[model samples]
Target: MGDVNRATTAAARAPKQDRSRATRQRLLEAAVACLAEHGWAGSTVAVVAERAGVSRGAAQHHFPTREDLFTAAVEHVAEERSTALRELFPQGAAGDRRAVVEEIVTLFTGPVFRAALALWVAASNEEQLRGRVTELEARVGRETHRTAVQLLDADESRPGVRETVQGLLDMARGLGLANLLSDDTARRARVVAQWAALIDAALGAPEDA
Candidate 1:
């Protein structure tokens, strides 16, 4: 009887746990969309909760403060972006550096990047958000750099290899910033091709080779 009762209780808790996770995910995704569309001044916990189809109280249950919610949302999306990049190139970016470069650039120009930019702007002005946003940006930057190194099969031990990779990311960010003003598709393709050639010249042999 005791064993059966324990098993029944465990089964009952499973669905509740699943629902809680789903609710949290909805709130995070909603927060990103709100930040992207509405900017920091417009995106409130109440607004995000409405977009998420959850109550404000529930949103707070997941993230007690507005800063907590937005920061966590951006971090969650960044992690998802990294996972997506890896999934898109499961075999690794051995050949076709152009494709890898283009995809990485795409990450910066996407909605998540826009949402993160909004947070960055807000962090610049908001004292309460500065530290968390700074820390989050640092972590995301490190992960992005590590991902680029892996995809490029780069050898950081080599002279200038690290800087070259960092330059690529910086250039991509600049391109993303430019893209925010207008459709830069034509110029972006040209730049991406140029960068791919430059990467090949700079990196020399792939780490595998």
Candidate 2:
């Protein structure tokens, strides 16, 4: 009887745990969408909760403050993006440097990046957000650079290789900023192609070469 009761209690708790996780995920995703579409001034816990189909109280339960919600949202999406990027090249980026370049650029041109940019703009003016945003960006930047290096099969021991990868990311970010107002697809494709060629040259050709 005792063993059966323990098993039943565990089973009952599983659904609740799953629901909590799902709710949290929904709030995070909704927060990102709100930040992307509405900007920092317009996005609030209440608004995100509405978008998430949850209550404001629930959202606050997960994230105590507005900053906590938005920051966690961005970081969560950033991690998801990183995982997606890695999954895109399961075999590793051994030979297809152009494909890698295009994908990396795609990361910046997406809604997640837009949401992060909104946070950045808000952080510039909001004293309370500046420190958290700064720290979050630094961590994200480091992870992105590390991912880029891995995807590009870069050797940092080689002179200027590190800078080249960082430059690629910086250029991609600039392209993302340009994309904020307009499509910029045609020009971006041209730039991506050229950058791929430049990377090939700088990285001394792909492994398959």
TM-score of every model versus the real structure = 0.97, 0.96
Candidate 1, residues 95-148, lDDT tens digits: the string is 767788999999999789889999999999999999999999999999999999
CA-lDDT, candidates in order: 0.93, 0.94
lDDT of 2 by residue, 1-209 (tens): 99999999999999999999999999999999999999999999999999999998988999999999999999999999998999999977888889999999999998999999999999999999999999999999999999998889888888999999999999999999999988999999999999999997898755444
TM-score of 1: 0.97
Every candidate's CA RMSD: 0.9, 1.3
Residue 125 error for model 1, in Å?
Answer: 1.0
Candidate 2 least-lDDT 10 residues: 200-209
Check candidate 2 and list the clashing pairs: none
Write down the lDDT that model 2 would get: 0.94
